[model samples]
Target: MSLRVTFLGTGGAVPTTERAPSAIFVNREGDRLLFDCGEGTQREMMRAGTGFGIDHLFVSHLHGDHVLGIPGLVQTLGFNDRTDPLRVHCPPGTGDDLHDLVHAVGHQPGFPVRIEEVGPGDVALSADGYEVRAFETTHRTVSQGYVLEEADRPGRFDRPRAEELGVPVGPAFGRLHSGESVELEDGTVVESDQVVGPPRPGRKLVYTADTRPRERTVEVAEDADLLVHDATFADDMADRAR
Candidate 1:
């Protein structure tokens, strides 16, 4: 399956006519993950054609613009009768923030939202042969970046070649695919290495949240298929952003 990334909001701190805030949509195998739900994130998601019901939301920081839309999105999902649980991930103390927001919004019922505070070395989401890892980022407050990667897939076995050699499709085929020697009923031996192709390489995507330039960010983005870095200002204003 192909992994695609859509920029929901690209502006930082402020919303522009062309860009909203800091939100992105990572689509993998029909799963939609939101990174940083800044102001107007729900509207931006709709504009980007990304359906509602995001299963996972990764908050880069506790900035107002970064997380201000959480309460609204939660209410919207409930209003639309969405039953699937939503998971929110951020640094420590994020649960308290979410709880306070929910309370401030009058605690809408029927929408189950799970808030998880995470730090470096945390796995935000893992399933369907893919995983997302969170790493701490340098910023005024606690922040983090994310790395999404696909698990390695086993090599494909040349079943047609085996069949042409009169090998039956049964336990012997399983053994050959699993890198083991298989002895046929007629005393013929088949080796896995002869039938299996090279293993498939995994794909990786990295997102650098709001943070100053640092070596860790470069390391996190190493060899990534997609590397998204926070560039809030022009090159001349780099020092100001830092």
Candidate 2:
């Protein structure tokens, strides 16, 4: 499964003509997730052709630049006649604010919008093959980061070795690949380990939107395939940024 990440917006708190606010779209195996719906995020999505069919929206904070697009996105979806429910994950104590914004447009969308409050160390959302974990982040607001980690995948299957072991080229091969032992026609039990390699590490992506460098970010980003952290200021201005 190929994983694709689209930088919808990368500007700072103030959007520029070249860039919108802060929004990132991650599509892993076609399971789309939008991180931080900043100002004009829907327009950015349209421009990028990512569509508004996001599976989940993960907000890092309650800052206007970070979440100002929720109302517009909800209204756009309503105009498009969307019927599927949309789940929005946000930091603790900010769910109510997000709820207010969802309906701040003076009309509710035809779909159901669920606001989930997640704290540090909480599994915010669990999907078929991956999970979104929350981590502490240092920011002006009560913010948190997110880590999207996929489950370990099965190792490569040695088809030649399986066939050499007298295993048939049928369902037994699938069973062996699935880590199950299979008995052959001659009553010979073929172990999965003999034909399967060690388990492979799955892909991991971490997003720390608008946060200072924190230990939790480093911890969650360990061995991650992609780490998207905030760089609102340059290192030369580190002293002033604090």
> What is the alpha-carbon lDDT for the whole of candidate 2?
0.91
Candidate maximizing lDDT: 2
Q: Per-residue alpha-carbon lDDT of model 1 for 67-182, expressed as tens digits?
A: 88777788788889988888888887677876776555476647777888887888988889999999988888888899998887768889898887677888888888878887
**Candidate 1: lDDT over CA atoms?**
0.83
Q: What lDDT score goes with residue 99 in model 2?
A: 92
Q: Write the per-residue lDDT of candidate 2 for residues 99-122, one digit (tens) a residue.
A: 999999577778999999999999
**TM-score for predicted model 2 compared with the true structure:** 0.93
lDDT of 1 at 182: 76
Looking at model 1, the pairs that clash are none
Q: What is the TM-score of each candidate against the true structure?
A: 0.85, 0.93
Per-prediction CA RMSD (Å): 2.7, 1.6
Error of 1 at 207 (Å): 1.2
Compute the lDDT of residue 35 as modeled in candidate 2: 95
- lDDT score of residue 86 within candidate 2: 91
The lowest-lDDT stretch of 10 consecutive residues in candidate 1 is: 101-110
